[model samples]
Target: MSAPANAAVPQAEQSLRDTVLSRGYLRLLLLCVLLGVPIALACFFFVGLQHLLQHWVWESAPEALGYAGPPWWWPLPALVLAGLILAPIVTRVPGSGGHLPVNGLGGAPVGPKELPGTVLAALATLPLGVVLGPEAPLLAIGSGLALLAVRRSAAADAKARAVVATAGSTAAISTILGGPIAAAVLLIEGAGLGGARLVALLLPCLLASAAGALVFTGFGDWTGLETGALALGELPSAAGPDVGDFLWGLPVAALIAVLVTLGRELGRSTVGFTRRGSKAARTVACATAVGVCITAYALITGRSPAEAALSGQATLAELAADPHAWSVGALVALVACKGLAWAVSLGSLRGGPIFPAVLLGTATATAFSGLPGFGTAPALGLGIAAAASATTGLPLASAVLAALLLGGDAAEQMPLIVAASVVAFIVGQLVRRQRPEGATDTAGAAGAAR
Candidate 1:
């Protein structure tokens, strides 16, 4: 009986392998490679434009206006304008200007009809200092374009379309997050899939992401344009973590998880608020509130509002390169102000939630680095992994993302990073379980509006 059972298992495995390696699946794989090119190009231009607009708003405009940097009052008007611009798109356009950041990045792919709204909403808000990142919009664009290309084909069923959409989205975000591996890891962990089904989805995602990375790199080199990849330029040097680092890091990671989860709760509350009244008015109000937070950070810390505004990628790089440049008070203010802005933006704005969450964690960890056992590098890695894990609810992806960000230092830090991510993920789950039942209803209602 045991021998017979083992024989049946091999038969089943062979059947699964045969299905995946069939001619149709092979065709689909080839299509993913072709699909990756255009998707990558679209994302490249999309991110480039957003970066240009951001530079103008925060840098060029300030210089053009004869100010050394943007004054404290700058974000107020800029964010108001962003709100005004984004209001109509979110209220009137289809797809409600893409999925709310609070929803995480697991929603249905944006179709062709919804792409314009996603682009408009992101352009209107993100460049103007809405505390969000481009990953959401890029995901939308990639999926929409992929669907648009294949929508007329009778052969493309729902499952095929879904696979292609996943591939396209991964391709779209590949460069931004480092590469296809990180993007694929995000999908794999976030999807909660297993076995043959997971493998089926994984193949196209990897192929598309590889092609996309190639296009992104080629175009960036050819055109001398920036791809706006997430990177850490310089990090404080540190050897492998000592026992003390782990002792302090474990608690700090938990604290970071709590804070990130708290931000998500705040986002859920904001979602309820936005849905209660006129969405347009409330959206503008929320944008302005984010602006107010950015302004407050600048005023309180006497630092550039740019540090608190936009996606935190630039600030993240700066902080990583030179952690000591910022005082403890300044780091605290960043966590408070940018964290609030990030939470609000998560509910009411059109963007991704992960980037700012990572920054919050990094800031928090850097602030606590003075503790007896904690070194800046270990804390930085731990903070990144913990915050990302908490925000995305994907410990493996968070760990991988932190490792990628850590670059050469990643080898030494991987163990601590992985532990931190797991701790954060567990804590985040507990926090979600603790949320009031009513919050789920509010989230559903908010989801319905989008």
Candidate 2:
């Protein structure tokens, strides 16, 4: 009787465990969908706002502000205004205005309580020609809003709230990142999560991302503009990889890795310095200096000032389509100017670093493609992966983004991108490991001395 009873108990426990797991997963999935709605809405709002701002900057702002053309100094005053607005909000608000989106890529989860200030600050800085992208703010806003919604509701459990927050954040930029898969992969790889837990987390994330994409598409259609999943035009046919291609990739990857390491350190130092300085001073000084540098570059190169500022997506696209349009020297200069601008931007602004880094890499690769045996398109793809992976410390996502951006040409370029990513990853890791024991002290000393 005792043996029989024990056997029944084990069976009953197993059934109960299965029941709980199933119920938990189901609830999480539902919560993820619910959380995803607000994030999608926020992303839609920001993207729409950006489009409106672009139109205003190009057409209305010049006339409205009494400028002869898109005033090169236009972004500066706006940036200063943004800084003033953001400073007080961040100081008084929770979550430090969503952890400065520029610095939040590999950061931990933040709650909904911090949404208002972060979203406001990001909107102020992002469209003002600050060298940052909307990706980080989108994530913060999406997740924060979702968390807030969940908190207001009485039905959400602790586990359900966590799942929703994660899903909302992941879905916010899902389409912006080419697709939801890339965003999902980024979260998974960056967080080092796996197994059944990962699957449970992913189901909701994927669902939310799908929903976000749908929302973005609907809004874009309504606005008569483009949004969601960047379209690659006229992809060149991919050829099989050769030994020479692989060999050429190694050195280029190594060079980009080194540049990324330098940029990362510079960004860290700049951010620290700015954080310690008076907010207004840092905002004005950085904006003025960057503005001057960009103006000089544009004047010197006889190119649009846009080339010297922002994330350079347009420049990158043009270069990729026709490398010969710009002189190699000009491209090289663009790389240097943009890199420095991005470093400074990271220090004093709130935005993502990925776009600028990709732009820099693409420009460099396009310039170097004049060499024998290296095709422009392939080199651009490889450099994109290498530089992105090195800077963001996400090799897999880099490889996928490069490949996806290449579209049909991904097959041939995929291997090269992967190889470059691996090398960059190793170089970046080694550089990170080799930092001096008193690096923080040294950095502080340098800042103080400055």
Predicted model with the maximum lDDT: 1
Q: What are the clash counts of all predictions, listed in order?
A: 0, 0
Model 2 worst lDDT run, 10 consecutive residues:
441-450
TM-score of 2: 0.78
Clashing pairs in 2: none
The runs of at least 3 residues in candidate 1 whose Cα sits more than 4 Å from the true structure, single-residue gaps closed, are: 195-237, 433-450
- Model 2, span 1-450: residue lDDT tens: 799998999899999888768976777677677767667876887878875775665457777877655555554565566566556665566766655423436454556666666677676666666676677677776666777777877877775666666677678868487778878766666554453365346435533553454456456556887554566554567663455556776688878888766776677777776777586567557666566666666666766666767666666777777889889889887877777777777766666777788888777777777777877767888788887887676677777778777877775566677777777777877775465554431100011011
Give the runs in model 2 whose Cα sits over 4 Å from its true position.
1-21, 63-82, 101-104, 152-159, 194-236, 433-450
**Could you give candidate 1's per-residue lDDT for residues 107-182 as a string of tens digits?**
7779999999999889878999999988888888888998898999999988888888888888897969899999
What TM-score number comes out for model 1? 0.87
Candidate 2: residue 87 Cα off by (Å)? 3.6
